[model samples]
Target: MRTQTLLTAMLIGMATPAALAGPAADFRAADANGNRQLEFDEFRVFVDLRANGGNAQAKKVRLFKAYRLALGKVDYDGDGIVTGDELIRFDRANGKS
Candidate 1:
């Protein structure tokens, strides 16, 4: 628990934005391989299994579009993928303290 707290603190400190995005747990889960990054594949699963609830096949046809939107929204580097730092910054900018 202590480690987790530290990690969360680190994440928040690293974040650059000022609004809440999603919970840290959400980002951690979405970041497969624990690489602190979310490739389209990881983002896809995260989107489908988000707290809102949805199935993988439900948005198969629109995942690509969603990816593009995600890029525009949080992929600050425009590197075709979402990083933990970028997401944290976005989250903070949105509302997360």
Candidate 2:
């Protein structure tokens, strides 16, 4: 019985982070129309800014490019999209949530 209690506590402790892992605001961005979809054009705007001599925007452009790649990898359902649910799951799996 003591061993059982200890095991249960351990399991709960290990599971706590997963349970608490939910969507976060920073993991998302707004699109042109102010909708929250990870679209290509939103990313391109950053690139365009940099091309126009916005060095600060270049940094953001690179960051978003990396994010886009990472998000694409997580979009397993392949609806050519990554919804909030998908983002949450990806973050939880990566321990970022």
Candidate 3:
């Protein structure tokens, strides 16, 4: 548990805030179900939170696009869920984070 915490902190700390474009905290916040993994709905909520919208409707639109793109990029096993490990691997593989 200690090691996992340390590793999470290390990974979070290693990425500069700017590089992540607000996603580090966003990812944590997105885990809304508290399951330590992101369901599609939770991920949609997260992407919605991170998206910029001129108004509520615009935000929803942006969120939908972002969610679709993010789902494609992160859901590696097509299991319809995303784990932190999967997220990390996706980011690393894509030259992100």
Which tens-of-lDDT digit does each residue in 71-96 have in candidate 3?
65567898888776777775466456
The candidates, ranked best first by lDDT, are 3, 1, 2
Clashing pairs in 3: none
Listed in order, each prediction's TM-score against the native is: 0.51, 0.40, 0.56
lDDT-superior candidate, 1 or 3: 3
Model 2 error, position 36 (Å): 4.1
TM-score of 2: 0.40
- Candidate 1 residue spans exceeding 4 A from truth: 1-22, 51-65
Question: lDDT per residue, candidate 2, 1-97, as tens digits?
Answer: 6543332222221111123331122222234555555455543442343334433423433544543543354465876555556545654565544
Clashes of each: 11, 0, 0
lDDT minimum window of 10 residues, candidate 3: 9-18
Relative to the true structure, candidate 3 has a C-alpha RMSD (angstroms) of 11.7
Question: lDDT (0-100) at residue 26 of candidate 1?
Answer: 57
Q: Which stretches of candidate 2 lie over 4 Å from their true place?
A: 1-29, 34-36, 43-68
